[model samples]
Target chain A: MVEPLVELKGVSKSFGSKKILDNVDLKIYPGDALGVIGPSGTGKSTILRIIAGLLKPDAGEVYIQGQKRQGTIEEGEPSLGVGMVFQQSALFDSLTVDENIGFALYRYSKLPPKKIRELVERKLEIVGLPGTGDLYPAELSGGMRKKVSLARAIITDPNNPDNAPCMILYDEPTAGLDPIASTRIENLIHDLLFKQGLCRAYAIVTHQASTIRLTTERIIFIYQGKIQWDGKREEAYVSTHPLLKQFFSGSIEGPIP
Target chain B: MNRILSSSGLWSWIQRSWAAILLSGKAIFFLITRKLDFSSSLEQMMAVGPASLLIALVTASVIGMIFTIQVAREFLQLGAGSAVGGILAIALARELCPVMMAVVVAGRVGSAFAAEIGTMKVTEQIDALYMLNTDPIEYLVIPRLVACCIMVPALSILALFTGLTGGLIVAQMYGIADTVYLDSIYNFLDVWDILSGPIKGVVFGALIAIIGCSWGLTTRGGAKGVGQSTTAAVVTSLLAIFVSDLFLSWLMFQGLGQGATMIGQ
Candidate 1:
């Protein structure tokens, strides 16, 4: 059997008797664009963090490209080949947009300054924020910052192929964004998967029904840290699962909450 | 039972402080073992060093003048006025310059470090660093550490010179001859006395930087937490400096029977 790019096997996490996640198993194969949809504060983003190796699980294991993730990020082994774009855009406020995009490359890649700048420019162009590399994160609009953040996450280091992320996790990429900006981000996600095809897989944790329905081939519904429903796009809209129905229909009369 | 109960708070403080110290030790170890971002360290030094010079100099100068004013009159009345510069030099070199300069830095640079890093922690910038495969110690703490260690000692030296200049001005006001004061300094002060101040500066600098960075890194909550960390960092750094000064003074100057007395003479 071909191994998945990333896998979570029976993973569980807790904080002081509060079970944030429990017995969660997930897999992302090559070419998979998975959307994780659920209510806010129900460990949706926590799943992304776990997959990105920002947090440890209390039980089971996380695997990156089939290797069992073995050390903490501080230990210098931060789940190789996984990149995450945080909900808040998390750009280095001290750095310029290009500098933030080129940060990991400038640190780890053997690429020279000129080449890194070129790559950064290309990423900026790809994100539809061209020629804005000199601007700082504080100077950019919220959507612009998010786009720059996405550009930062997926900018491939050509000099060092190993530094390239095979998969990316996006946490609430459209949160607090207007419909136009959200659609732009959604289109960018689709283009990133189908056009550029640099990364093999991605997991998006978002509440936007449009983002989930358009950006993902598969959707997993998480409620209270467990996978409440998992299905294809067509199946998701038609599923008789009460929670999924409630979530999709935006109905208050359901098992949720 | 009472003792255990009474000391629990102290024990908890020790545990927390020790963790911060251990993380600082790890930062140092990483600095020694890994490739560091020297550009960031350079920027930090530029921000921390020359920016702090005026205040450090002013404080040291005022302290030197005050010490001279208090000592010169008493010594002159006792017919021991020639010893004023020597006493000032000994006191400033042994304790005053380093301790006071550290206090200034802990209040200024140290508090700034805690607030900045604490803000970063609360806002998930630290987490972003981790996500980007960057160690916070290597990226943040070590740069600040290197800057503090270099700048504090450099500032202490400047403060020492400024202090001596202050003493000279005060001596002139008291109608004491420059020759007599300079001669006293030459006769009573040694290389060890001057060197001790810089050594203390290095230790105090490390303590301030480590405490500030650790407190910031460990900060929870939000803006309120950052505020608390800033205050705690400065307070803890001052406490560490004072307590460590007592031990460091004893270690650096203890059992030096002739040298200690001769410096004062």
Candidate 2:
């Protein structure tokens, strides 16, 4: 049996008096493309953050490549590199595109600036934003900024394969984008996963129907701090799960509320 | 009133204060270990030092002129015209220059640090920094702390000289010859008095940077949060400076041992 790349067992998180996740067990295997879909404020993003080791669960264990995570990312390095693409792109406004993409390399890698720049340019080319190394985040369009952030997520140290991301978690990667822009991002995500083999596993948290249909092979529907339904992508549309039906049909007449 | 005291606002402030203290401790540790980004520190120095020089000098000059105006007439009427320069120098070195420069920087640079970092916090750039395997304290707070620590003192020294020059010019205008003013300063001002300004500046700079950066890192909400953090950071820095100044003043000049004896001469 293939081991799961990442697993969250009985993970729970809360904010103040509001509980976001409750004893949620989730697992992602190598080559898995999972979509986590739910209504707003349902803790999809929180799950991604927990998986990336950016946020610790109030209760439970997170196993990264079979190693029980000890603490938050600040405490120690994870067994595998987990890259996260934020909903807001989160690029440093003061740095150029190249600098934003090559931030980790410039800070931690033994490579020279010239080599880092070359790698940054190569990542930019992969993200289809070539020759944009000199431009700031403010100068780019919203979609371009998203692409730039994608490029940043995929950048890795050439000499240190251990540091390369084995799993990528994208939080709302296609939200706030026009359909055409969403299609481009979806295509790029597919290319990175299937053609480029950038990561062994990935998860996307998005509300976009097209993105869920196009980019994900498996789907999990969350509601009221628990997983309502879990199944393959194709079965999501036809499932009789009341919350899933209401969520897919855009109906207010169900258990979702 | 109990409800007000128990409000989340108060709790949040406590949390932020604790976070700031932790950040300051971490930054000092990194500084001791020499684990810092030199380029970032240099960039922050430019912002904290040369960029703020003009305002600091202007403030010091105006203060000097004002103090001289207030004291020269009184001193001259008492047949002690030569004491004006020494008094001005002592006042500037002991209290005025360091406090005034700190206030100026707290308003200018401290507020800016809070707003910039608060925005980054709201936008998740701080989390992104963590994702990229960068410690935000080492990358962000230490540089600002280093800049403020180094430059605030440098600015205080410069401001002290500028204030003296301003007092000298004003004294000359008041018919107390430049020679008289120079002689008085030479006789009355001790080396410790001159060194105290920069010493206080180093302490105040640390307060400003640490408070500002801590408020920023603990910022919640969005634009309104950033605005509040910026305001709170400046206000907190100002309060910290004044409170620390009281203790620093006491520690450095508790008793009038030397200055009083020099006056007896």
Candidate 3:
């Protein structure tokens, strides 16, 4: 059996009386690019936050590489070795592109400044942004900012130094991009994950159907705080379940309410 | 119904502001732990401090001239215009110099810090920091706090000297040449007056930094939220300085009185 890179058992979350996630049980195998699809506010992002240990579940256990990770986030420490790219390109406007990417390696690295600069350059080059370090977030176009943010996320590439159960938790990575940009981003996602091959895993939270088709091998659809369907991505659209039909149908009135 | 709704809406806004402050306090405490970009902090200080010098100089000069004019006018009419030097020293040392300098900084640079940080926060860059295993406070708060602390006092000292110089020119212009202006001014402006204001400045810098950074970290609701926090930081820090000024003034006065009275007794 392939080692589960991440596991959630009976996880539940609520904001006031509104339940966001309900008994979410999931497992991501090593190197699997799992796509989580759902309508807005269906707790897709909440699950990502849970897996990254950013938000604690009201009940249930969360395991990263099968080790429980919780309580540390509330205390201002992210225990899971998960990197996240938020729905919005959350790059720091104040810091230049080089500084932004360099943040990940600023600590916990013994490399000298000259060496670190080389490493940072390599990370940017991998993202197709070569020799544009001094530029601020404001200078970049939307798609460019998203790519810079992606470069920042994989700055360390845990597989490079240690196989640390690394997972890139992408939140709407291609949501705001144009079709061409979206396709490019989607391809990058697959290429990066393929590079992970049998070493790193990935989880994406998004609403775009095309993004779902291109990258994710496995799929889970969330609705009303629970998993409505879980299977291969190709099977999701054809699933006869009422929830999947209503969601994929883009109906105004669906099983969601 | 309208009146009730308006009152409730006002009440929640106030409540939300208070909660944001409290929540940001915890975040600030976490942020000051050395997680922020050190190079950025150094660069920020260099940027903010060097740029503010001209403003401080202008403010100091104007305040000095005004103090000298007021004192010299009153003294000239009373045949005590010879004491213009003493009057300027008393005014600049006791109250005007440090207070004015710090207020200017709080208004100009402090607001800038709050707006910059608040916008970054609303955009989710700080969330990115967490994802990267970097503590936002260490990365964001410390450098800013350190910069403000160093810059406020440095500017205050510059303000003090330039302010005294401004008074000297005014005194010389008014022909209050009988008394030794420089010597008298120096004598009247005591150690307490000089020391107390800077001490207040150190405290004021801390207040400005905490309020600004806290507001930034706790900002929500997007761009409008950033604007709101920036405005709140400037308003609150200035208000804090003024309100605390009363107590600080009283403490300095009372402390001086006791020391003088003891000597007389």
For candidate 3, lDDT tens digit of each residue in B180-235? 67766655666876777677777677667767777787778888988888888888
Give, for candidate 1 chain A, the lowest lDDT window spanning 10 residues: A70-79
DockQ of predictions, in order shown: 0.66, 0.71, 0.61
Instruction: After superposing candidate 1 on the true structure, give the runs of residues whose Cα lies further than 4 Å from its correct spot.
Output: B1-15, B256-265
Sorting all predicted structures by lDDT, with the top scorer first, yields 2, 1, 3
On a 0 to 1 TM-score scale, where does candidate 2 land against the true structure? 0.98
Q: Please give, for every candidate in the order listed, the TM-score of chain B alone compared with the true chain B.
A: 0.93, 0.96, 0.83
- For residues A1-257, write the lDDT of model 1, one tens digit per residue: 87899999999988888998999999889989999988887888888888887888899899999889875676677658888888889888899998999998888888889999999999999999989989999999989998998998898877567868899899889989999999999999888988998688999998898788779999998888899888797899999999989988899989986
Higher DockQ: candidate 1 or 3?
1
Give the candidates in order of TM-score, highest first.
2, 1, 3
Sliding window of 10 residues with minimal summed lDDT for model 1 chain B? B256-265
Which CAPRI category fits model 2? medium
iRMSD per model?
1.2, 1.7, 1.8
Tell me how candidate 1 scores on lDDT. Answer: 0.88
- Determine which window of 10 residues in candidate 3 chain B has minimal summed lDDT: B256-265
Clashing pairs in 3: B31-B137, B31-B138, B35-B138, B35-B139, B36-B138, B36-B139
Best by TM-score: 2
The alpha-carbon lDDT assigned to residue A10 of candidate 3 equals: 98
Best prediction by DockQ = 2
* Sort by DockQ, top down from the best: 2, 1, 3
Candidate 3 scores an fnat of: 0.69
